[model samples]
Target: MLYALGDPVSLVLLLLSFVVAVTLHGWVQCLVASRSGLRGPAAEGRTRPDPRRHVDPFGAVSAAIAGIGWAKPVDPPDRRNRGALLRVLLSGAVANVVVGLGALALLPLLTSSVGSLVTFLGPSRLLQSGIEGDLAARALLFLGLANLMTGLLSLVPIPPLDGGRLLFGLAPRSPGWQKAEYQLDERNIGVAVLLALMLIPLGGPQALLPTILDTLAGPLVRLVTGA
Candidate 1:
């Protein structure tokens, strides 16, 4: 069955999902920072809560064009609490993982219920034929998968990502570990750029990652829709 404004609706849903995912990512970071007693930029009078303070223009544009976005880096709190820093760094990735799991759990229900509702609506032949429930399913599936990918990728053992933080946090607090941590920070920008470039292919509609996400999403949607 075709939705009357399927394409528009899908676009809206995708954007909304992205915002929600990113917001959750931020919130988790804040919460972890607070819990770990990490002073944020705000604590140091260096920034405000506004996301603009954390916005990276290049990242935003890249995300708009490529669907991979990033937040601006804030100055680390004046008092360096390694534990707190680690928590703040890891929080966003953890949020994404949580959301991804939830999406996967809810997917089957969404697809099945939506499928049935569209069928029951008895829309016009043209509308029904055009709605492309499969497409909608694919879109949502990709959304969930996108979250999962973001979460997993952040865990890569490279500079600036959550994995790097985890590595430093777990390493012994010796001169060698401290030196390694400093090295990681020094090269974070380059590492992030390289990783972002490598991930470009994942953004394509027909990419293998998207296809995998759609496949995983299908069952959850069917379950949700009771199809």
Candidate 2:
């Protein structure tokens, strides 16, 4: 992905922004999970904002190239409490949206083009390296954009995404839906398909996950920040 991009500084900035966004995204989940009485994250020291605790290498690479990626998935405490499980699943996305909004609020203090700076994620909007502005301005811009996209992408109802898990969790316990959900999770069919959609441009709408996410998030960022 960086093969086609330039500006070593901008690339570094992009990666750093992604790392921060991904770190926060994962940390919030871990924190919520821990506080919700899920011991896995707390016991493993995953409740902190340490990038090493959260960032998945493959997922980070995917985010650098595709603009949307996930963090290390948290292990569930157990399946006994469905509400707690759902809250843990939901926290990552909500945390990102809040991070994005916070960035938007701070951007105006740094640069006048808050709207354009955060919204102009060039070249299929795949987290390219055409960013411009001072160091702080550019960093905040990418941070906001990355976080917003992450939050929204996680809400997409594809298997393995938070939304998908939430959907399957909430589905009526009919034997048919239960069996289907079990098959999807057991085979990891959804994860593979999502990875393909992110990394492989299959010349179809389905393959445009990053683009779709940018479109959904861009307008909102622009309108709110520009306001």
Candidate 3:
């Protein structure tokens, strides 16, 4: 059940989660760009911050609707740091996974409190207690599942994703696979876009993904929080 509160706690958490996700996305892009020799002027140690130097707008918006998002890309790192490209490329997805795990850990605390508050607030309040409770539960569930999905999805061996970077890093050493690896990066954007469009018809933001996440998170929440 939901408690009627003037405080914007839900809004705050939502915004914070978005920021965390976007920042990780940006850092990952920066790492990948540097490794791929796509550095902009800023990477040369220029002092000015150029908004233009960051983000693929189409990609970011698509992510937002799809429960994933990207930030503006950073200039590539210095050549000295280039050797760490694979690590950098994978870092964003790694960060997302970490967030997912963290959410799972924290789910009990969030759900218990929200559930209790909703019940205590009673049913006649402006905000229906039961609905609020469900939303809060769903939000926690989404946080964990969204992060997990983002991490896993980005690992697909397509360009602009973490998997693509891993494939490139490994391909050069593999006998006879170099040409195929090179072709992957060239079509990364097209592939990613196609995937995003396909996902949209599968239920937009509110359908199957959320349902799957809630289903996965439910048992864990009940086990930990005794809900």
Cα TM-score per model: 0.56, 0.84, 0.53
Q: Which scores higher on TM-score, 1 or 3? A: 1
Best by lDDT: 2
Error of 2 at 134 (Å): 2.0
> What lDDT is obtained when candidate 2 is compared to the true structure?
0.72
* The best candidate in terms of TM-score: 2
Model 2 poorest ten-residue lDDT run: 117-126
Off by over 4 Å in 1: 1-9, 41-62, 73-86, 112-143, 169-188, 199-227
Full ranking by TM-score: 2, 1, 3
Q: Return whichever of 2 and 3 wins on TM-score.
A: 2
Winner on lDDT between 2 and 3 is 2
lDDT of 1 by residue, 1-227 (tens): 11324466544554444455554555566656655655664463323344444444543443444443445433333324665666677777778766766665565754654444433432111121223456656455445544554555456555555566566666678999787777766756635553355344565533333234334444543453456
Model 2 C-alpha lDDT per residue in residues 1-227, reported as the tens digit of each score: 26326666667767777788778878998888888887888788898899998887656767766766777767644556887878888899899988887886787888787665445543235355435558887777777777777788778776667777777777788999878767665677767777777877667543577767767776777666774
TM-score of 1: 0.56
